[model samples]
Target: MAQSHRFWNWIARRYARMPIRDQASYREKLDRTQAVLQSDWDVLEFGCGTGTTALEHAPHVAEIRGIDSAPKMIEICRERAAAAGCANASFDLAAIDRLDQPDSSLDAVLGMSILHLVDDRDAVIANVFRMLRPGGAFISSTICLEGQARLFRQVILPIGNFLGVLPRIHAFSRTNLIAAFEAAGYEIEENWQPDEDPMKAVFVIARKPA
Candidate 1:
């Protein structure tokens, strides 16, 4: 995990300048996520790289605390937030499991393009569930590597990770991903694929029962 953090730090500048490949799909996700947010709600976003999503949703919520394990990522995030004059948005360097929030304290939690990178998806989901207030939402977008080319998943991805070119990747299916949330006691409010790619991007909005 330390090495992974360092790797992200080394690439932070380049990562921040990388363009969004699918703007339309990203906009749709932002719109859907914003729809469930209230101006009085407090939100948390894990793996919030460069703080783009958090800043985007800042105006819709009372406050947003975005965290990433990578210190440099959090640094860039904080810089962006300051540049944008987003008083309600803040960034911190921390892992998901290390968040120092009380249980049932947050009004919402966001995870975008993060689920597939973590080693323990269930633990992350459980933490998110523990943090949210009843009726709060977990809005996320994930790259499901299940549909990726067999050679890439079985060969290239592992090689890339070994070479420090990529972080860990977990392959997950849409059905099982939804099942994980349901098993964690969240009711699926919405789930869909935003783009038609071999390795698809999935968006979900799940609510904790009130």
Candidate 2:
């Protein structure tokens, strides 16, 4: 785990230093997700690192809570939110498996690049299902693991695995992802692969039946 932490520290620093082109990709995804939000909604953003997107959409929502498991990430996110004057958004250091909110209280749950890192993705999905009110939507994007082997797995991730790296858990097939969502009690609303991004990620929107 120690080596994993170091490896991730480097990854985080690298992400923090991403060029404008890379940052644009993040912006496009955030914008696409935000465009679907309703005006009177209370949102919960899972795995909200640094609270950047939460801050970006705070002005349009009734309330937004940014949740992350990493203390350092939460701290940075809180600082970023305050700096951005995002009065409607707050950051909490909490894991998705152990959500602090009441069941059926949230209107929407947004998770960007999160489930792939979790060992118990199904549990997280189930918990999110309980938290979102009936008729609520869960918006997310996940990497399509089948295609990643060519670019990231074989070409790159092998180096990390050699260093006794942490297990980078990922299982993203269109069928598998939709099945997981259905298993968690959501009905699929929108599912597609946008060509603007190169990460092989697929955008998905699902709703809890009323």
RMSD (CA, angstroms), candidate 1 = 1.3
The lDDT for every candidate, in the order shown, is 0.88, 0.74
Stretches off by above 4 angstroms in model 2 are: 1-14, 20-28, 154-167, 196-198
lDDT of 2 by residue, 118-176 (tens): 76777888888899899998888777675555667664666655664433646567678
Model 1, span 119-202: residue lDDT tens = 789888988999999999999888877766779889988887887877778897888899999999999999888545546588
> Can you give the TM-score per candidate against the true fold?
0.96, 0.83
lDDT of 1: 0.88
Best by TM-score: 1
TM-score of 1: 0.96
